[model samples]
Target: MNFPSFGFGSPWVLLLLLALPLWWVARRRRPPSAIVFSRAGTLAESPRRGQWVPRLLFLVRNLAIAGLVIALARPRSGGRTEESLSDGIDIVIAFDLSSSMLAEDFQPENRLEVARAKIKQFITMRKNDRIGVVAFSGEALTQVPLTTDYPVVLAAVDNLQPGQLEDGTAIGTAIATAANRLRSAPGRSRVIVLLTDGVNNRGAIDPRTAAQAAGQFRIKVYTIGVGSRGLAPVPVGRGLFGLRYENRPVEIDDSLLTDVARMTGGRYFRATNAQALDEITREIDRLERTPARTHTYTRYTELFRWPLGAAVLALFMELGLLAWRAPLL
Candidate 1:
């Protein structure tokens, strides 16, 4: 086991310990006898064996004095503790699960798979932040609520699929839903990360109106449009064994995305491939960082009682021994 740090509150009191040795030396010097003997060996028959008794008493007295000196120094034991001084940012990630997200322009995997991996990596880079997840296609759905549990958010991101909702993109609805989740967060900084690959084709709300509302609520929205320019292989339907793909034009509403981000005091990013997507996440991470502070303190417990008690006990033992030897003396 580990021992707590030890210290003295009044260290100057320890100077008293230096006097003990001088006192011992003075005690050891034999004083002149009150009655003189005719010769030096006249009382040789008397027992000299008990001469150590007085020395034993002196030793106990010195121990008692030493204990008292230590107690006066105010010994104590201390332990350190730390606490976070700020409530970090709160964020909600809005993911697009439209059928178009299955486009294979990102290589090795589709756009949605690459997005999930990057979102998980972003979550891992954060500390002291509460994060939530929102998945949208034809409409928006809250996959996870605002929380500090990163694992839950990661799991929700991993479980997101294109067919969960309908087959269209609702960028406006996704932003509105994510903004609502962050409006009530207690953090000073609240954010919405909207990652979509298509324009807003289905939703009751307008994208610009949602962005204005988010700005009013002091929530910033960082928009990321994911896709390669020109033609890409997009999955249309399932065949006899696997998915069928066709080359289609990649369409991303870049102008509208930029407008939405600007209205909400955020920036817009375009991810053409997996590497760009990773860099976008990193950029957002840098932009949304909240400078958090921590406070450290050390608590001390008084330990003077033990030494004071030892001092009293030693004095009592010396007194008892002296009383027991009184009759013989």
Candidate 2:
């Protein structure tokens, strides 16, 4: 099995290792006991025995000291697992895909392009939250389902285009579709962010009725009216060479959106530009956060016992050998 990182708990205790050399020097300098040999010739004639006892005893002494030092530097391995206390909020973004979204009044790009960029940014910020996407025009469709997998949501948002759906604003159907997705979500808080730049002109259900349904299900509905007030550049037609642009009046039903938000216990926001859209998303992010409970724990296995045991056994063996080899006095 793979083990976690290993380290010493009391590493400062390892400084005691410096004394091992000093001890060895002291042992070497000590004077050896003198032995008188009245009959040197007879002793030389007797069978010689190995003189390795003193060296063996010295090795044992050093090993005992080393083991003790290692034991002092406590060692352990592994890491703690922590559970997040903040629960994620489930969100569904209902995007407008009507032809009016192609208007270029927002600058460098059209309303749909700017909205897509801001939506991507919003998804990036809420990494822990589960998000889904719904694209609406004359009809509503679930582009992506609720999921923590952010890449799928981002991809769906990036692929949004005006001509994919029938060209009409179905604000009511969009809300109802988004609410259906959130009804079964497991998060503590469920929300739908509806973005549009036109008045509701299609679908059987009314926008207010859909908002009431969301309220009944305890889901929040934040509505955003996207576009600059007054005349904005719009693509009228394509000639022999390229597309043609003309100044047309911008039309956003902010009153209906505000009413929808009021019915669902949510807020309505007006985004005249890209920056305002970003700010509106950030505000919704702050409002959707709910408190959650979490748990955390840590486990460690100590390794000091092995070295300490070795130190004791080595010291005992050394003492026993010395006592057995000592001459009678």
Candidate 3:
């Protein structure tokens, strides 16, 4: 829950509090008696009933004075509000799920697993942007359309597996599918982030042709090559106990990826490990930010009425007590 900000409009009025002590001392002093009593010691010898009545009246009167002083300060509560006055960017993520992505180059987790984790983090970092998801192997499939709903995008990324589609890297197809999704998106700028771990060999469209098509629509495409250098452990077949692993040479077409990025006025990134992948995503986030202007406003509500009422009520109570117990006081 958000709390309102509290403050006084006329804070200088609080200096009146300094005079309270002087008033108290003056009230405590007794004036000289007009007539002297010779047997006054006899009255002093007996205990006085309701001796605390005067003290109680003084306390009530002091409370009333304090409340009135605070009311004069013009206390109020305020709340601040902000509004954004710009459109957000539209982005589509093209994820590769080919067999090569299963390579355990990032240790403990496969390349695809680490990529999924990083992509999920990337999705959460974006604000007010509509994001879409495209899953591709031998062919491309749109897992989600452009939307501001992030949970649905994260769920689609988590559910992607190595064998969900045909067992080949369709880099060109993935780019084409992502560009199609962003062709008429609701934003001034449209973007595609395609992460692949292998060379293109299955798609009907050529990688360069797809990049040109994206360029025609003025959509920026950021390509990412994911994997470590040299060999990486991969699952080949299932054994009696569990899945079996075999080291395989890492393969990623850097030139084609770079060309695709350049043709669409974007940049190509190489992620050798998990840390590098994380850094690449952060860099992309910094590059394609939506410009926005924010306007802030503050609303204040007067709270002096409450303190004023309290002061009035305390004065009434003090007057009633003085009338009922005048002799005791």
Per-candidate local distance difference test: 0.87, 0.86, 0.87
Q: Model 3: C-alpha RMSD to truth?
A: 9.5
Candidate 1 displacement at residue 204 in angstroms: 0.1
What would the per-residue lDDT of candidate 3 be over residues 129-208, giving only the tens digit for each residue?
Answer: 88999999999999999998999999999999988898898888999999999998757789999999989999899999
Error of 3 at 277 (Å): 0.4
Stretch of 10 with least lDDT, candidate 3: 33-42
Candidate maximizing TM-score: 1
Candidate 2 residue lDDT tens string, 1-329: 12466777778888898998898898779775453222355347653332355677778888888888888887777744577877578899999999889889788888999999998999999956789999999999999999979988999999999889998999999999999999988777899999999999999989999999999989999999999988998777787887677898888888999999999989999999998998998998888887655556677678888888998999998889777663211
For all predictions, the C-alpha RMSD in Å is 7.4, 9.5, 9.5
lDDT of 2 at 49: 33
Write down the TM-score for model 1: 0.66
If both were scored by TM-score, which would come out higher, candidate 1 or candidate 3? 1
Q: What local lDDT score does residue 112 receive in model 2, on the 0 to 100 scale?
A: 91
Candidate 1 residues 219-288, lDDT tens each? 9999999999999999889999899999999999999999999998999999999999999999988888
**Model 3 misses residue 118 by how many Å?**
0.4
